[model samples]
Target chain A: MNLYYRGYLLGDVRRFPHWSEPSDAAGAEDAALADETIVYLRDDFSVVRSPVGADQGVLWDAMTPQWREFCDTVLRFRPPRESADGPA
Target chain B: MDRPDLGEQERGQAVGLPYIVQGGGENLADRLAEDRAAIRDRLRTDGAVLLRGFDVGGTDGFAEAVRALSGELLPYEERSSPRETIKGRVYSSTEYPPHEEIFFHNENSYQQSWPMTLYFHCVQPPAAHGATPLVDTRRVLAAIDPAVVQEFSRRRWMVVRNFHPDFGLPWQQVFGVADRAEVLKLCGDRDIDAEWRSPDQLRTTSIRDAVHVHPDTGEPVWFNHIAVFHMSTLSADLRDGLRELFPEPDLPANSYYGDGGVIPDDVLAHVRDCYRSAATRFDYRRDDVLVIDNMLTAHGREPFSPPRRVAVAMAEPTDAGARP
Candidate 1:
């Protein structure tokens, strides 16, 4: 299943592919992106969305180019399926 | 290396670590100054060294024992929980309501700096049931599911805290400064992201490694407060009450993955289970001292009846990334 990250910016949804977890340059974005609310999504249609970090909008730019593009595209934003466990 | 007369060891079968009782007439307080290195060696090797019959007299004596073990006690700075500083670097341990159980955690693991060692002295045992349970973090790492451990390592963790006077300790009390500018400076120095969530409220988030190798022992350990700080850990009633009482952004404290995603509840449940299965506990008698290597061990409190008093002191501050 493909992994994607969904971030909330000013009530708008920014969807992108989930990249490798931050260690150095690739993970932590710049300070300016601290306002975005990040959440992890999966193609398996799981209803639960795991929270990444809040107020870390600065790190959005640190994502890879491909993931950044995915975040910019809103049409591809697929919501998780409804399940018994409900959204997390 | 001088040693105290020891009594029968207990709990050797249940967990790998055993509790050593001191023979009568021997006081660790008098002996620790001369034998600090030996005791420190034992702490590093065993993860926890429980001393009963040490005759650590009172708060003053406990502070002395701490000083003997690790020179120059560090002030409890950048605090999250409420605790009273009794005397020069000695403080009451997380002075929470006696009915609540304080979950196991490495001291200051959420901060950019933490003490390498911790000392807890039992000034007075609880009236009914009070024991400081201990768990080896290495065992916590091993007990968790491999996938869960892998996920934690990859994603890391970030603790988001909203400090306000309405609930919990305010930022002014936590940072030991009343001025907003000073608090901002302290946050800046510690690499914490601080913001004025509102006119009177402050929000801070700090990222930390979920798993880290012990600085002295070079052994991997689960060393973050994700389980303890997560909102899911609270009871359903308490969580609901809190959500109703405060706005979402102003909730007292909670945690998330380093990348700003939610940590699954099931994962945290598994983690709590591992901690429970591995925890070791011994009755705390008066005049007892427990010294633990903070990175190698995690500690928590059990719900007790009343009249329980334990003093804590920390030393040997190790800055983040300083561990080789």
Candidate 2:
């Protein structure tokens, strides 16, 4: 189960055995960034990266404490819009 | 067996897979307060996210969840698929037969203005194979051959639509206007080229970019309904039957180059291949919610078995105009 505090997903709290991390993939850097790792979060509370130069970062476990804290502090949850249709 | 508090951690299997957050019987109000910013950032970066096991059980719960995300609600105007408005900002999902597979396309991408965000609430998941498959548009752009992408970008694309009361959706239903003057005014506002074949029949064409860049991230994404709208999507038998009824130009819907040239079959085939290879899918559970940035991702439906009902809500309308 993913635990989120104030819309920020808290990491290092769980493990996902079924997911296979992609290998040595590199997307063209976002036009706004230069020489920075393109980091994204995976479903299992793990952080992932596209390879940088020759460095293929470790999978699911390389998320640093600082990154985790940043996500925890900055992420916000958005709920569904209110509707009269009521719950299903 | 594991305790429920441990959380079900099901990871996706691709580079652009959606991140899933499972609920632990907590009220959605509490969940929204915990991470609205994280959810937004992930959506901007990841394209799609799923929330399962939450209290979003019915139309009210679904609407409440959507409201918590953003109060901005977009109108479902200029629709292509058949859907009925259920309540305030909530509508039934596409009403296609269960046996048919809906091809991948961005919601309302054919229109000049479309909802920036989309939410899907699953009331009852099918007993078998009712998965709403998603593909990250960024990944799709990356996967397609650069040469083909460049050619499409240069040529742009034009969608041709003919609304006939005898077949498909009539102009009245499509534009939601009964009077011709109102329909003409609406079309004029959006730069749609409209012509009247008869008092009730109408044909329209709109040219749009085959690719679009996200406003927030500046990431280029594949954003068009070219493959789905093209004649190639129809089986030969269906195509022949349709041709017997109307000329190629008078088909319910079709696509071509903005300059009125033919788009080759091989090009569309290449695009379909990319979508198939890049798609990531997961089964929908009752009360699950899937949120997506409309321009950042594309969505489609797979053939399902029984008892599937999904409701949709859209918000944050953005006008792409003639460009991204």
The digit string of per-residue lDDT tens for model 2 on A1-88 reads: 2211111111222222232343433335433222122233433335434211134243455455654553343321122222332222
Retained true contacts (fraction), each candidate: 0.00, 0.00
User: What are the models' TM-scores?
Assistant: 0.73, 0.74
Error of 1 at B302 (Å): 0.6
Listed in order, the DockQ scores are 0.01, 0.03
Candidate 1: tens digits of C-alpha lDDT, residues B1-324: 000011111211113232353535455666777566766776776687767655676777777777777878999988878898888889998888776677788999999989998988888887765677777777677667889878867887899999876778878888888898888888999999998867788899898888987777677778989888888887677779889988766678888889888888988877876775445555677776888888888888777778998889999998777432
Using lDDT, give the best candidate's number. 2
- The superposed Cα distance between candidate 1 and the true structure at residue B157, in angstroms, equals 0.3
Error of 1 at A34 (Å): 43
How close to the true structure is residue B133 of candidate 2, measured as C-alpha lDDT?
Answer: 75
- Candidate 1 residue-wise lDDT at B214: 77
TM-score of candidate 1 against the unseen true structure: 0.73
Model 1: docking quality category: incorrect
